[model samples]
Target chain A: MYGGGGGHYDGGGGAANANSLFGGGGFMPSQSTAAPESSGGGSLSKVGPERADAAAAHREADHGRGAASDDKSNFAINSVEVSTIRLVGRMLGKVERVTDVAFILDDGTGKIDVNRWENESSDTKEMADVNDGNYVIVNGGLKGFQGKRHVVAYSVRRVTNFNDITHHFLHCIYVHLELTKSNSRLPSQINASTGIPGHANQVRLPNNQATTFSASGNTAGNDVSSLVMSVFHDPAIIDREDGITVAYIIDRLKLPEEVIKEVMQKHIDDGNIYNTIDDLHYRSAMNG
Target chain B: MDTSSPAAIVNGEILNKFVGRRVRTVVQVQRNEGGMVFGQSTDGHQLTIKSAMDIPVSHFMEVYGIAEHNQTIRAEVCTDFGPNFDAKAFDGLCKLANDKFKHLFL
Candidate 1:
C-alpha cells in the first residue's frame, strides 16, 4: 500500500503478508479494518501511526535547534523579530559604485545607509529620479556587518504624499505595540493557536469593526477618535446630564493624556463633541 | 553618521521629556526673527527654534535637532511642510509616537 510507481497491492494478500510478518494476533485488529478498503489495505493503515510518530519526533528535533540552529541572527526590536522593514525617510546623500548604489536616509528618527545592487537590466535606473532632500519609501532587509547596521534595499520609491510619512511612523509604532502588547489585549484562544513568536501575520485583534465618527465620516472605527466616542456613546454615559469628565475618559481609555486630549480636540473641531459644564468635561453633540 | 541615537517625535507637551536629546517636532511658523524662528507647536505651546537659515513665516516647518529646553530646539535640519498642513493630525501622531507607542520609534 505504501509502494511508489503506482504499483497496486492486493488487499487480501497484503493482510496475509502483514499477519505472517507480525505473527497474526498482534496486527489482526487494524488489518481487519483495512481489509474493507481494497485499495488502501493493511499496510497503509499500519504506516499511519508510524508517520505521525515520525512527524512528532521531527518537530521535537526542530524545537531543539537541530534544524533551525542557523536562525540565531533573527534580530528583534521591542521583542518583534524583524526581517524586512518598510521605512519612509528623506535621502541625505547618495553614491554610485561599480556594483551597487548607496544612499544615506534620515527619517527624522535616525539615519541609515541603504544599498541597492546594480544589475545589467533596465531596472538599473530605479534610483535615477531620486535626489537629495527627496522623501522616499524604502523596502529592505536590515543587515549588520562588522557590528554596523544598514539596509539592503529591494525597492525604493519617492513619496508624493506627505501623509505617507506620517502614516509610516504611526504604522511602525502600531506594529511594535501590537506584537509586544498583544498577549494582554488579545483573546486566549487566538494566543494559543498562534503560538509562533514574533510572527506579525498571526496577530489578530478581537474586533475589526470600523466605527465611523458621525462628524468626520472618514475616521475608521478602530482609531483613537472612535474609541473615545464609543465611551461617550456607551449606554451608561450617553444619558448623563453632566456628561463625562476628561479624567473619567482617561481612566477608561488607558491612553496617554496628550493623546486623549488631542482626540477630544479633534472631535470638538469636527462637531462630534462639545464642552459641558466646564472645559474639563464634555458631552457628545450627537446625544441631543 | 551617528545612527546610534534616534530622534523622538514630540509635540509641545512631550518636549520636556527629551531635553538634551535629539528630537523632532512639527510647528506652524508664527514669525522669523533674525536667526531664530518663533512657532506654535502642534499642541498650541510656543516654541523657539534656533536655525542658521531663514525659515518662512506662516508655513508649517518640521525641525529635527537636539532639544535644548522644554520649548526650544537647536535646529540641525529643517524642512518646510508647506502652507497648508494638518496640525491636529500631526499632534495626534506626536502623542502616539512618544507616549503610547514610544518603543517602536526609540
Candidate 2:
C-alpha cells in the first residue's frame, strides 16, 4: 500500500530483450516461504546523497588509476564484461535449483542469473531467504557459459528501500559519464611547487576549453587545470542529480568539443572523473 | 498522447529550452524532501521539482511544471503513476524503468 503520488503502475512489457540466460525452467530451489526480511524502506532517506559523497571520496583515493580493479566486484548493470562486477535488482522468478540454485536478477536495463552454490559457506542463509518480487543487491563476478551471462555471487542482500534502485542507476550514469568525458593531460609541475600530495595527478584540466585563464607562462597548463576544476565545482552544474555531460559544458561555457575532450581526458588521467554508462557523459570527481 | 514515446530532450540541454515554459514530462523521483524532489528524466536529464504536493521516492510522474532558473522546475501539477497509485497505466512505465535504466549503473 505505497502512497504519495496518486497514480497507477503501468509496466510496459516491451523492454529490449534482457540478456537473461534462460527463458524459463531450470531449477527451482526449495521455496523459503519466509516473509521477506524487510527494513521498511529505511534506507530511502539517506542513500541517494551518499552516492555523490562516496564517489567523491572514491575519486580522491584512486586519482591515478585507470579502473577500480581492486574494487572490481563493485559491478553495475552495463558492466557485463567486467569479471569483477556487483549489482542490485529485483528477483524475477521463483528460485531455480541446479548444482547451485539460481535467481534471475532484473535491473530494468538487463538481467543476469545469480547463483548460490550449495558448496559455498559464504552468506547463503541470507540469500536463501530472498523472495521473488523483492529488491536485492549482489556482489559477484560476471561469467559466460553457453553464450549467456551469469554471476557467481559473493554476497546478496535484500533491498529494503526502493529508492536504492534509482540511486544505483544514477550512480551508474555518473560513472559512465566520468569515464568517457574526462581526458588526461600531461602531468603538471604545479603540484611540486604547491606541495599538494599527488597534486600533479589531481590537477585535471579541460586543457582546450580553459582559455579563459590565458596567461602565457610555463604555468599555463596549471591554469587550464584550475579552470576545469572550476567547471566541476560550479554549484549550478554540480547540483543536477543527473550529473553533467560534455555537451552541457561545451554549451554553457562556450567551449569547443575538442577542448572539452582534452580536459575530460585530463580529468580521467588525474582520477578526477571516469567514463559513465557511455563515453559522452561525465560527473565531477567531488560528486563522483 | 503516447506517454511511452522516447523523450525528445535526452539530456540537460532540454532544460535550456524548457525554462519559463509549462511543460509535461515523465520523471523518476530520486529524492523528495521539504517541498522539493530531485529526479532524472528517462532520456538522462536532471530535474528538480518544487511543489506543494507530496512526491514519493522511486516513483514515476507525468509532471506539468515550469522550468525555473537552472535545472529546477516549479511544479504546477504532478500526476503519479505506479502499482500503489494508478495501477491501470503505470505498470508499463515502472517495468520500462527497471528493464532499461539499469545500465545507468556502474
Candidate 3:
C-alpha cells in the first residue's frame, strides 16, 4: 500500500503513530491480494499469489524489502484512519509542487504528496504519467505535511471514463470512496475461474469488497468521517474461475471491555466485528 | 605449531605479529585458507567473504596516529581499536596497505 522511505510527521500523537507505522513499512511488507484474485485459487480458505505475472511483479517490487507496492489492498484498506483515491468520477485539482521535484494530489478526502528521492536520478519514471484534472489511481500511504494528509503514488494510470474500466480488485471494507465521485454503475460480480468482470451489476457495495463493508449500516464508519483506510487497484481479479471467497480478519481484533462478548461470539459466528477505529465508528452507526 | 592465534585476524588474512598484552607488532601478512564475509576489489562488484564463523563488520576501516587520531600509514603498534583514527578528512589515508574498503584477508 505504501513505501516507508519518506519521513512525514505531524504534531499530534495519532499522526506520529501513523508516520511511524509507515516509516517501518519495509519491516513487514505485504504482497498485493491481487495475485490470488487473478489466479483461480477457488478454495475459500486459501489465498496466495493469484497469477505468475502479478506474483513476479509483486515479488520484484517487494524484493528483499518490506511493505512496498501500489496495491497493498487487503489490510491497508481496512487500516488507514483517513485516506482517499481518485481513479474515476473526479475532476483533476491543482498540482502544486510541494518540493522542487514532487507534487501533492488532492482528491475529496485529502491530498497525498508525490514523494521524490535524492538518490533517484530522473523524474523520467514520474513525470511520464498523466497530469492533474484527469482521473488517475494513486497507491501509497497517507502522510502528514504542512497540515494535510497526502498520498505518494507509486504508479499512476489515467482514467478516461468509468464505464470503459473493467477488472478491478476492490478489496476494502468500504469501496465507495475509491472514486473522487462516481455517477457510474459500480461493479458487483466476479468470475471465479477467470478473475474477470462477469456482468454490469450493482450491489449495496462494489464487488471485490468485503461483505462487512457498508456505507449506511457500517459500524466502523462512525468514529471518523468517511473513515477511509488505504485505497488502490488490484491488478489481479481478472477473468478467472473456480471460486473466490472473502475472509474477514478484523473478526480477530479484541474490542473494548463492554463489547467483548458480543464481538467475540459474533466474530466466531461469522458476525461482523471490525478491526479499525473507522470500522468501530461505522459499526456503531449501523447498530444504532 | 599454529602461531596464528597470537596474531591479528581480519578478513581471514593473518598478520603474524609480535604479541603483546595490549598491542601486537606487525610481522608478515598471509592469506587465510578459510573464507569470511568481506572481500572486494576495485572497480568490481564487492567480493563475498565466506566464513565458517562470524560475518565481517563495518564496510570501512582506517588506521590513524595515536595522538590526534589523524589517519596515518605509520603505526609501529596496532590493536583492534585500529591505528586510532578520528572523523577528520585525513581519516582514510593511513593504511600500511591499500585502504580501498576491501578485505585483505578473507
> Which interface RMSD does candidate 3 score?
29.1
Native contact fraction per model: 0.43, 0.02, 0.00
- Write one digit per residue (lDDT tens) for candidate 3, span B64-99: 111111111223222121222221212121121123
lDDT of 2 at A114: 73
Model 3 chain B: worst 10 consecutive residues (lDDT sum): B63-72
Docking class of 2: incorrect
TM-score of chain A of each: 0.41, 0.37, 0.27
**DockQ computed for model 1 against the true two-chain complex using alpha carbons:** 0.16
Candidates 1 and 2, the one with greater TM-score: 1
Tell me the DockQ of each model, to 2 decimals.
Answer: 0.16, 0.03, 0.02
Task: Please tell me what DockQ candidate 2 reaches.
Answer: 0.03
Docking class of 1: incorrect
Best by TM-score: 1
Residues A122-164 of candidate 2: C-alpha lDDT, one tens digit per residue:
3445556578866666544444444334567645566543344
The prediction achieving the highest DockQ against the true structure is 1
**Could you give candidate 1's per-residue lDDT for residues A54-107 as a string of tens digits?**
100000111111111222223232222333445567887788778888988776
Q: What TM-score results for chain B when candidate 2 is compared with the true chain B?
A: 0.61
* C-alpha lDDT of residue A173 in model 1: 40
